[model samples]
Target chain A: MIDVQLIGLLNATLQAATLLFIAALGELITEKSGILNLGVEGMISVGAVSGFITAINTENLFLAVIVGVLSASAFSSIHAFVTVVLKQDQTVSGLILTILGLSLSSLIGKPYVGKKLEVKLESLIDIEEPLNIFQVLLNQNLIFYIAILLMIFTAYVLKKTMFGRRIEAIGEDLKSADSMGLKIAKTQFIATCVGGAFAGLSGVYLTLSYVPYWTDGMTSGRGWIALALVIFGGWKPYRTAFGALLFGFLEALGPRLQTYGFEMSPYIVKITPYIITILVLVFLTIIKNGNTGAPKNIGIPFFRENR
Target chain B: MNKFILSKKLYRNELATFYSFLIGFLIALAVGSLILFIQEKNPFDVFSLMLKLSIGSVNSLSNSLNKAIPLILAGLGISIINSVKLWNIGAEGQIFMGAIALNFVYINTSINNSQIYIFLLLVSGFLGGAFCILFPAVAKVLFGVNEIITTLLTNYIVFGLTIYLINGAWKDPASLNFPAAAYVSESVYLPTVIGKLSSGFLICILFTLIAYYIKDKSVFGYEMRIAGGSALTAIYAGINAKQKAFFAMLIGGGFAGLAGAIELLSQTHRVSTGISQGFGYTAIIVAAITGMRPVGIFLVGCLFGALTIGGSVIQTIGVSSYIAEIIQATTLFGALIAQFFFSYEILKKSEND
Candidate 1:
């Protein structure tokens, strides 16, 4: 029989992966539409605070989740305006968004700091067995199901749908897209907002389902990790979700290993995600695959005057 | 149908810069007012209070001066690297390395001399910061990796390293339960240039002059700008872009390291991760806000320094210190938008239509 601890570890891995998958899905869609929102870190933090505050006061997960999504989308609208409408540097604006998110969240989240909630998101269905593989995999929260559905939804839209093709077309060749009469600004703006909403949903999961607490900088660098995961996944939904699961396993492995009572530096666990990102980038470039799954116009702003 | 559109200005018009910055300031103030109104406080009173506390008294002004020392150094570092069009986001890590280096030197060296050792400590700190960015610089040149990700990741790694040092190896046993690095001796502390502030301000001024000379007069500065403008063009003109990137990163990292060392030797007096408080990121914003001009960076660095110190003054009035950060970020975003207007003008729809 598999020990209870091992099963718990497996379950934690899925939970962690689900959060990353949701956020990376948002980034994937954003990047697919030729927009880079580096403000995921900021957006996630904002979502975390807003979600936590809403959960505490209202105890309504539905409202908390909506607030979380809308607030982040609202925050990222500035980015869309700057990068898409105004034709500014997207990278700088995205980074600035992060700074704004973090500072703003901390500033506004002051009263809600150190607060806790009684209710938390529970597993959709109770497990039939105590420590079985099926129980570990199937008995998960609503967000886990959302993540799986989103992956399929994203993959289907990007492959079979005309909307996905339009986004990809714009990302690949903005001039061509513009000439084709595609609404570049409108498309990018909506895609970016959706990305922000997904990112914020990840934040709600963090505060509402995962830690179920409110604190400053609680999202930590998960947003950055998700950003990297999008790249590591080669901008594909399936691959990115897989990569997130792998990362989630790695994240869970460290803590689970600590429970084994080994003398190790916990700091190693903290640095793992960061170190993994650089390594992934290095190795990916080294392989030099024919197609390096990146949106060609990822960071470059589309200037209408240029053509 | 009539619609307004921004047209590119052929010549660099000074009026555009003024108009854009004015608009940026106005937008930032408007947003700030909304927040203040929501909080039920007079926006004017708070703004004036922040201004008064920051620049009104000698003590507060000196405090701002003291704070600006590190910011100016870090900003100058960022300015130089930015001129080469290579982002050095690792300045935060570099600053930490600098603080770590000086702390190791100060506590371990047991150097009895003052002047020589202090100078040596500052240099070592600069070297420490430089070494932090060396890897990303070389990797970018040799491997074609993105420095933005690498630099940012390295910062986290070094931050973790700092936590390890403070909580574990460097933790003072006598610190009780606090778990901090060893405290520096009083003798090695930087001398005061003014009331309650250390002489690091003077050193920053010297660096500003040096930075100005390099930017305008130095042959290397000329090369860096050309390389930044267009790398393919620079290469066609026989300029080695790799060497420029290498040296540019080196200089940028060095300045940040020096800031770290000076911050420790002058103000903080010890090593800790919180010592930087995102100065590396703030310096990047400062460099951008000032248009990457050395003198502009100096003046703007002081402005940010004042804003930081003044941020604390309003907490008692039911405000959060993060309000300072919100204002700064809003202004940064506004200024970024302003740059667009500065570069372009809305051509009035002529009646010729």
Candidate 2:
């Protein structure tokens, strides 16, 4: 019975982890191309609204995911243009994009406030009768399986592909990459847009697959937590997945604690992810490992012609 | 020659500000109109009402001034940090923490003398703001953590910690359910210099002058500028980069703290969660709009403050006061977009090309 419960817990963990995994993967691609995306929350919010509205209209869940991803990618392009091309302060630009996106989403999503939708996709797939591992992991939504496949694919691309080499080079030294005839701006832009798509995809999971309701500021701070998960994972694809799972566990921990009759402040539970992030940061600092690598020029606004 | 005179350098600069302001206002109006339309309301009436309420009379003007004072102070706080190439996103947190610190001091101790009261208030405020900065500064130096994330995260921590305190430890004995601190003693309240206008507004002007003087004349300011301009060059010039950064953050935090203190003593007259109401965050827009100039911050802050006050009074015309948030956001959008002109040029492609 305890073992079955543990499997159930793990299954629950995967559900929560899927959204964050998508977001972190998206952020990783952006950061790998040397642009730190702080507009994850905004992108997610836009995604949530876009996904919810589109799903309600079309009644096609997959189409909603596509719309959500595309919108998020479009939203993230603004960050790319300002930071990569315009060479503005990345942090300020990202912060402004966040505020703008938040307000813009609220304004645009005003009509659908308080309305809820019953999604049909939740029962569309049930793989639990198949192979045990697949049943345990892939038995959830199609998006959950897609998210895992994306992680594997991303890890493969980052490690084995020539495109990844160029991205790595750009992140390591833009000047050197430029000298070597790489298209710096183009690479960063594409990566950023793709990253944004993942963030949006995460939003689709929330709207179409998870709650299937429209609420103002529904994405909440999941985007920021996703960003932190990228750091907690020490900037590796596999570790990033694990970190997302850990965060999911913490997120689910709130409800579990309540269920287990251990009454705790919801605020304290709400703060657990942040507290864990700080703890992870402190632990990372103390270990002082030389192996974990962040992109050298991650937040630096690249000005090609200025040099 | 006529064209040259029309495009004269001084006129060109004035034209820039004029165009920017016009564009910002129009954009805000368009957005506000769109929102009103969605809600099935008339936009023109709402805007007209907004204008009337904001600038209609002396009372509204005073109300706007009252709003502008704290915004001006917050803007100054933002400008100081930005001038040194630091993004102090913790101002909201700093303001709240500062208020909490001041209130803690206020409720516990009774100071009869006015001088001691002012002294303790300023000290607590400065100390509170400074304490908030310590985390980011330490994170920057020790952990290689960017101050941006640390500062931003500190905001939630401060808010959470403060709320925890008010609920658990500092809940007023007499209040029914609302979590509120004790009423501050009258001696601790800031003196009102103008009729109905609190002395806090005066402090904003004083700080602006102080900021200008320090930025222009002081060696410390020069070091900060050098540090901001180039970290390598500052180090090459025998300036202690670490010390300068630490000092700049401290001053930035202290000024923000002082704003919180003044706000509590003058306006709210007590510490509460909504004391700052995102002033610290909005100040970023003020600072950026001003291009990190004290004069610019003062003007922009006043503009926002007036808009905020005007937003409320305009509700009689059926528009929500929250429209100010949209307008402020639009101004920031305009200001950031305007900065693009400074950085890049847009030109028509030639037919041959």
Candidate 3:
């Protein structure tokens, strides 16, 4: 019975960690390319709404997830355009996007409120075999496996590849990189868009695999946690996966503890992820002596010439 | 020839801002029209109806003015900090704490003594907001934690704390099952000064003047500009960056708190979660769009206030209130894009540069 309980708890933890992992990966890429995309929450909401609505209408989980990713990326592109191309304050632009996304999603998703759907993924290789921990962990919807693989791929690309070097060079010092024949604008723009695409995909994964249903503000605060995970991971893909897992464990443990007859205010338990973020941020602060190895040009707008 | 070059540059920059604003307006109109179009209604008719409802009558005009009151104050707070390059995202939280503090005074003590109570309430709100900066201020000053993170994090903490209190200790008993505090007495209410216009409008104007005075004429203001424009230069000139950031955030928090107080006492007449209503967040955009200048903040605030109030008027035509939000978002996007022109010239090709 104890072993069974442990398995259930670990499964819940892995399930809960998927959204944050996807989002943190997205943010990690953007930050690596020297931009702070604060619109993750907004993009998540947009994806949730889009994914939920598409899935409900067609009753096709695959199509719904695709729609979710596209919608979130499209929404995030607007953020990229405003902050990157237009040279606005990324923080303010992001806050506005959050409000816009939340309000817009709520208004549009009103029709589909309370409607539920069970996601039926296309059959895969026999993965859900009973009692094997590896199979149990890997038996999640295809997106969960994809998320882990993407993290590994991202780690390899960022650490080993030449493209990764250029991205790092640009983020470290755009002026120096420009002098070295790097296309600063094009590189940053692509990084931001790709980051946005992954962010949207995270939201799609949330709606399709984890929640498997539609609701307004469904992925509440998960985006913020994902953002914190990027910081906790110190901007490395592998470390970010670890941070996501920790967050997922905390979130899953909260409800499970209640289920096991532990008495605690759900509100207090809900604050666990935020409290952990604070602690991790403090730890990272100590590690960096306050600098935290931030991208040199990370929130600063780059102008081609001196005006 | 040099003068001509400068003039050309200025025109290009101005034109960018103008185009951004124009595009924002077009987007707003398109969104409004899209909503109507989707509803199978005539877009033109719905828009006209919105105009008629928002400013078409004295009642609606009063409503718009009331809405403008808190926005103008919050906009000023946003404007000041942006000038110093400090990201004070804690405004909403500051405002919430301010409202909570003001209510404590208004409810616990009898304001029936004199008109001084109003002044006291205003001061308390300002102080309350300033107080909310305690933890984050310490974090930034001592540890160099990005004020952005601390300030934003505090907002959720304060919001959660407020909800916890309201649901537990502060729940009104005389009322029905709703979670609310007691309605404040009339003596504490801000009096109406004009034909249905409350004194909140006058407070907004007065605060605007004070902010303008401090920003443009004060010696302290000059130091703040120096610090914001060039931290290295300011440090060389003997200005402490930590102290400057602290002072800017303190004032910013206070002004936002004052907005919360005004919102509570003058408009809502009770404390609730809806009091902030993105006003603190949107105020940042208002400040940015106006280039962080006091006069510009006032104008921008009025424009947005008109848009918000006008949006409600058009709601009778089955248009969602989110149309206002779309307008706000697009306008902010436009303004930020416009700001890029001030720093860089957009050439037809990279080779031109």
Candidate 4:
């Protein structure tokens, strides 16, 4: 018989994994369109701050999330303009964006510190008493379901669509894609914007559900982990979600282990996710020659130069 | 009617750069004003206050320079690695490791000579910073891993380990509640040169000068330029791209480590998690604004240093330092756009073959 603590651990895993999975999937789409966005962290920061402000002022969860996506995408558009149109270095722009985002959010969250939510995000599914496996799986915050739905939708869109093929072509060989009449610039811009939207939603989840309070720098490297998950997932949505779940499980280990009488140091437990990420990347590199599955022109900005 | 058409410039004159920075600063000011307006604060008042706070007196000026010590050092590292087109995003973690290294040396080794002990601590800082990036740098060189992800992930590990040390192993008993390591022996503290600025600021300048020489006046620097421009060109030119990559990361990481050591030895005098204060991130922006020019980094590092203090100035009136961040980011974007214009001019449309 499965223990209640095990079920509780699994539940915590779903909540933790949901936000990360959403962010990774968004990044996967952005990368698929041939741009390696290093600014997801920044976008999330902007989203979280804006989302928190929106939540507090309007007391509308959905509007708050919408604002979150919009603010995040607004910041990302600047990156797109710089890297895409200006052909500036993507990695540098991404770093600056993170600094800007974190700083901006810190400023925004300063006033809202220790502020509690006036309204809680209501769950989409309501079930009480005698919870079976189905009930257990179904009973979660609304954002959790949205994340699972998004994962499936993204995986479907990536695998079985003409748009997907266009992105794949652009990522692999932008010159060839341009020759074949693909809208490289437009597609990349839109993809990055869409990615930014989901990144915003990820931040919204953090403020509304995960941590559920306004705190400065609360995203706290979750954005970076999401970026790593994109790599470990090989830029595939379902795999990215799987990576998120595993990371979440590791994250939930502190509480779960405590229940099992392990009593590990929380700080040490906090680092397990990053340590695993580094080990996995190293191992993947050392294994040698099975296809890293990275987009070919991901970091190289596309320019309309007739060479 | 005239239409913009980009034309490549044969040689970039100094006028273009001057114009670009002027325009960049203007744009940043404009963006900052917008943010201030949203916050219901007077933009002019806050900006002027920030300026006053940064350089209103000798003590404050020295304070700004002291804070810029880490950024200048870290900026040099960013500029070096950037020459080889490598992203040095792990400077924050490297900075933390540098502090850890200095504390490790101070706690474990008993060196009485202040000069010699400080020198050794500096080396340890460099090693710690370099050590943090070595594994990832090797991975990037050998396995084709993206340095951005690898470097970034290492920051978390470094942070966790640092917190673990300060809270668990190296926790000071006397400091009742604060999670800081045992203070470095007072003999190890460097003498302050300016009002509050330590000799570390001078060390940062010296390192920047050394970096400038390596970047502008060395064969290895030339090789790094070639590799950054085109890997194929570098390989064909027999530049040994792998070695350049490794050297770039090591040198860059070392500079950041030195910054960490500077902090520990200069002011903080103790290893703590707040040592970096995002200097690693800010230095990347500084490097980008100057387009990795060694000289430009020095000037911009000072400007950013002022802004770093400016970030706190507004906090007195219940304003967030985010304005500083916003202004810095906007200025970087503006400068980048100007750089783009410098390289490719938008000429009036004309029929040409």
Identify the CAPRI category of the predicted complex in candidate 2: acceptable
Descending-lDDT candidate ranking: 4, 1, 3, 2
| TM-scores of chain A across candidates | 0.95, 0.92, 0.93, 0.95
Each prediction's DockQ against the real complex:
0.58, 0.28, 0.44, 0.64
Q: By the TM-score metric, which is better: model 1 or model 3?
A: 1
> Which residue pairs collide in model 2, if any?
none
lDDT of 2 by residue, B87-187 (tens): 88788888877888888787678777887887798779878988888878776656566577667777777777777766767777765587766667777
lDDT of 3 by residue, B1-353 (tens): 11211112444554555566666667668766787688687988876776766667877767777777667787787667765777777787888988988888876776556478888988889988888876677677777666666676667767776676566667777755666667777778888876567887888888899889777888777778888889799989998877876787788788888988988887777777766877776777677666677887787687777778877666666677777777777777766665566645543433333
The model with the greatest DockQ is 4
Backbone clash count for every predicted candidate, in the order shown: 0, 0, 0, 0
Candidate number with greatest lDDT: 4
lDDT by residue (A77-177, candidate 2, tens digit) is 98888777666667766776666667677766776887767564574356654345456765687888788789999988888999988888898899999
- In order, the interface RMSDs are 2.3, 5.6, 3.4, 2.1
Q: How do all models score by TM-score? A: 0.95, 0.86, 0.90, 0.95
CA RMSD of each candidate after superposition: 2.2, 4.9, 3.9, 2.4
lDDT string, candidate 4, A1-307, tens digits: 6667777777778888888888889999999988878888888888888888899999988899889989999888988888877877787777778888888788778889999988867566776631456666777888788888888888887778899888889988999998998888888888888889999999988888787788877888889989988888888887788889988887776656766888789888788888887877777656745377889898897765522
Clash pairs for candidate 4: none
Please state the CAPRI-style docking class of candidate 3.
acceptable
* Fraction of the true interface contacts (Cα pairs closer than 8 Å across chains) found in each model: 0.59, 0.14, 0.34, 0.76
Point out where model 3 deviates above 4 Å.
A1-9, A118-136, A255-264, B1-23, B340-353
Docking quality (DockQ) of candidate 4: 0.64
Tens-digit lDDT track for model 1 on A1-307?
Answer: 9998888888889988988888889999999999999899898888888988898999998899899989988988999999987788887788888888998888788888777787888888877555788877678888889889889999999889999999999999999998998988899999999999999999899989988887888877788888878878888999998899888988888766778887678886788777777787777755754246789888777765621
